[model samples]
Target: MIPSLGYAVLLIIGSFVLNLVVSKIRFNRKYKFPNVVPGWPIIGNMLDVPYPAGMWGVDMAKKYGEMFTLNIGGRRLVYLNSSRVVTELLEKRAAIYSSRPYRPMMSEIMSGGARIVLMGYTDKWRNQRKIMHSILNGKQSEKKFDDELLNFILGYTGTLGEYQFNPLKSPADVFTWLSRLPKPLQWWRPFGEKFCETHVAMFQKEYNILLDKMNKGIAKPCFAVDVLHGAAKKEFEISDVEKIYTWTSLIEAGSDTTRVAVLQMIAGAACYPGWARKARDLIDEVCGQNAERLPNLADRSRLPYISAVVKETLRWRPFLQSGVPHTLTQDDEYEGYKFPAGTEFSWNAYSIALNDKEYSDPLRFEPERFMNDDLKLPAKGHCRRICVGLNVGANNIWIAAACILYCFDIEQDPEHPIDQFNTLWEEPTKPPFKVRFTPRSQAHIDLIEREGNIALATDY
Candidate 1:
């Protein structure tokens, strides 16, 4: 009887091994593509992919050419290292390439499928996207908040990296069935639950506060007020819960990205003071040398050089190296290459932006590269899934950069030399580096104080 039991266990193990071999064979036959990166069997390329995939992708592109594929735990991903292919697959074929990749940890477990960025292309996602567009599609109002905002941003970065880059490092990430185990046994479940609770409470509190202010007829004309009571609320069909997450999602999308962009702008000025001087000269020509007024959105069209600086900063150092992943909804072919449905894809922002084919002398911080282009830098993204808040974020960065350049002469602090390439895995995206921000002139100092008092009075 004991021998019979042992034989039964051996048979179970053999069947499982057989199934795995068959699945691996099918996976290989199904995804016969070019420039496939070498990876392990069954596990595929999870261990091979690294952090800051942007740089790694650039290196891979140099070796493998423009398009390459990496299979991570049976799931294949195609990385577009050139803007040409990105435009072809993501833009020209937007109907199928607009959906997000499967992220069991980020989308379902942590966000409960409510995070707009990670949501799949579905009717609910469409409705939520509409709500986000209507509310956050305009110029952002300047509002101040405390450091608590950092917690959410940092938490999101950690959570996003889990599934965005090399997913399936944890088996449970791919085989979500493990999530069904008893809560006590599931080690990852509690953290996700806690994060969701805190995230919802923090945003919902702000939502409730805005609702109260609206009831008192004193709510400001902002995204929240617009969505809660303005005509947009009536136009879109979304629950109060969806409404709350939608606006917060905009904050999640914009806040940290805008911060990193402004920092990079300052870093650019420090590294290349000549361009900063040029930008200030242009600002002075438009706004006035005696600080008659601060640069505003109206002056944007006239300040082409400043606009160029903004573009150069982003191109030189893209904030999210791996622009969010997109998934194919159906089988498709591109240039004689077949992509099966459920194939995940992403653009190596670092690679595309710095490719010698796209930008000459790519390492240099030269705003002149964009000077001849249109002054008005519009944020018309690839396709249907175009960044809803990109325009607003860009404008915010533009104004902030204009104001900084107008008010101060940024210099690299000799005590602590700035490394523009230095970055952290956590929030603030760029690590804190000291830079000297000396006021350009006495007039600039006076202008700063005057504007400060005016904004303070307006807030009160």
Candidate 2:
């Protein structure tokens, strides 16, 4: 018995060694990808990537150049660190790179495969994208939608001081892996399940309200109305659960991302008073001192300086440091490097946006750098998978920034000095300093009061 056991142990060890050798040979034969060193066998570069997943990629790019590969467990992730590679592959070759990776946590467990954001490249995703386009693209997004969105934003920000945590944050990436475990072993299962239930209930409530209004001929031409109307006409198929997830996802996307951008803009205003002064001066130039009304979407073109500020704000600290990962549907090659099918790709937005080659003094908050028309903002991401609410979100930011800058002189609170550099990755609720928003003048206060009342009263 002892001899037989020893032989079995040797056989198992031999098999393991043979598998490792085969894996190495296959990896070497197919691709000469860089950044494969210092990784464990099988697991590969899982430990190499640091927490938050953004800063590590930036550091890796500095060492590995524009493109590099990190094998997380058995999955290969291709990191694109510059605009050149991102544009060439994600934009030019979007047809193959736009598909989402299969994430059991985000898709199957939390959202039950109904969330459009995590859905893989399929007929369902295509159909959902079409619906989103119809509602948020082009003429469908007009002044009414902008006004409604702005109102929602203002209402949320007005209570920022009262909140202990940011309610708008997307589910953390760690949950995506933890959710793969059995329910009994997944500690976050209850919290995630409750979170999903709460959001779904809220979405259902909103959908029902919109449906009632539609029946009464009082519905506005918003996303809910468009989606429900489409469903009524049988133009497409969508389950009740999907409708809830779809509308909620849109709300989360449209609101949460814009919230982060606006919050970052506020931080910028507080940290860099010179830029704030420039923006205010430009706004005053366009609207005239003590103007009759707050800045509106119509004034966007005239306030070029403020526009530059917006562009710089986005480029300096993009809300999503790592843009959503895309999966390759088939084996492909780029720049002599082979990418196997199912290889995941991610654009390191933080690295690309802050690339020294692209932006001079990339860390500095310089709005004028964008004024030369040399730097392009990657705030809305790129290619076919670009954010669906790009137009609406941009308009929202423009209006909010213009109005806020026009009314208030933002400054860092003396009680709490914000470490602008360190706060880039901080949660919204835990901003390093509380910003003081003092009205520039009584006229500014009056204008804000008048506009605020009107904005509150306006029905979308």
Candidate 3:
């Protein structure tokens, strides 16, 4: 009886203290704007969230309207839906609003602020952005990379898409697969996923040696050239050590995102057979099924369906589900909900892009859905800070798409439709290998083999 009484007394005291603490965390009208939403104790209303799934955010948005306040893990969350609110924060009021709510784990482990994606608006952020723009901006990426194109043709090109993918492969087989990757990917052959620590180790060695080669004119400068040559302007006034960190960030962003995009392309091609055929037909008309050279940017207009395929690929599986999350810089209130400063708000790109209301048939792989007039581009501020490599990414994707169609017909043969597109996401079609691109005929095989037979000149 004494023990029971003691427990009861403690519980009352604890409740009192919790109430006091909650009361102390003020959300007052004097400082904050019109606050609308309610938060629960401790975990807040955010405890209701269903996680590990991207659709939850959109469902919440519809329920709570475009803007709402949520409390998760003792922090306030302000969700901005629709185009207007996002624009107000990111673009119109850009400076005060652009800070990322750095996660405890990502900040601690990530190297040298090697995360420009998480960078708040600051001078260092400016430097990093400046450097990126200089290297890949406007005509430079095309001109510089194009100049090196011929050499790679006579040599080999490396791209992110695996020549082939399937479940359960040996590590040795993976490397061999990489070495003999098809076409444009062969051009980018040396680059591979850094998920393999060994791959990164090898990459670091190759990078240094390649830099030396560029200096000696033994090879050409792509990314390294602009950075080393100091074309990055005023923002790049830093030591070589600092530059390495910046370069590392650039490499991480550029490589991983594009790889995911390319993977999505392969998956979509198999699932959307009609789109695939249209793409091939366009390729046939433009390249004549026996073109001397691979498709480049100049050939894009002649091939509309193939271009659509590439565009749809980007929209289908954007590289990131969420951008680096943001934290409110000040205690702001709106719509009768007080959003305390330092609240976490991450933009959900996946949810926004695949929205049923926004997209006609969100689940289906229909490229024509994009051809709709209003749905042509993303709503404003929705994807604030557009992809820096937009043109290059597009160019590379289109050219590669055309080249592949010209040389091969991608379809699932002797396999059920279920094998091509994994709907439930468990086992997920062995990541893109559920679909395959068989060479259309012997002539197609001969041409690809003939063009792809060129020796890779590894100066290093």
Question: Number of the top candidate by lDDT?
Answer: 1
What would the TM-scores of all predictions be? 0.88, 0.84, 0.70
Give the clash count for model 2: 0
Can you tell me which runs of candidate 2 are displaced by over 4 Å?
Answer: 1-13, 40-44, 47-53, 144-191, 372-385, 424-428, 458-460
Indicate which candidate wins on TM-score.
Answer: 1
lDDT of 3 by residue, 261-378 (tens): 6666766776667777877776777666655555667775566666566657765655544444576777655445555666656555556566666566755666675554433233
On TM-score, the stronger of 2 and 3 is 2
For candidate 2, list the clashing residue pairs, or say none: none
The full ranking of all candidates by TM-score, starting with the best, is 1, 2, 3
Predict model 1's lDDT versus the native. Answer: 0.74
Global CA lDDT of candidate 3, please? 0.54
Answer with 1 or 2, whichever has the higher lDDT.
Answer: 1
Which ten-residue region of model 2 has the weakest summed lDDT? 161-170
Please give the clash total of every predicted structure, in order.
Answer: 0, 0, 18
Q: Which digits, one per residue and each the tens of the lDDT, describe model 1 over residues 1-460?
A: 9999999999999999999899979966765665888988777888877776767767888988888888777777888888788888888888899898666666776777888888888887998777667666544433322232445665566555655555644456655567678878887777777777877787787777777777888766666666665435377777766777776776666777777778878888888889999999999999999899999878877988877887787787787777777889999888878788998888877777778888898877788887764545544221123577767777778899999999998999998887655453234444567789898789889999999898767731
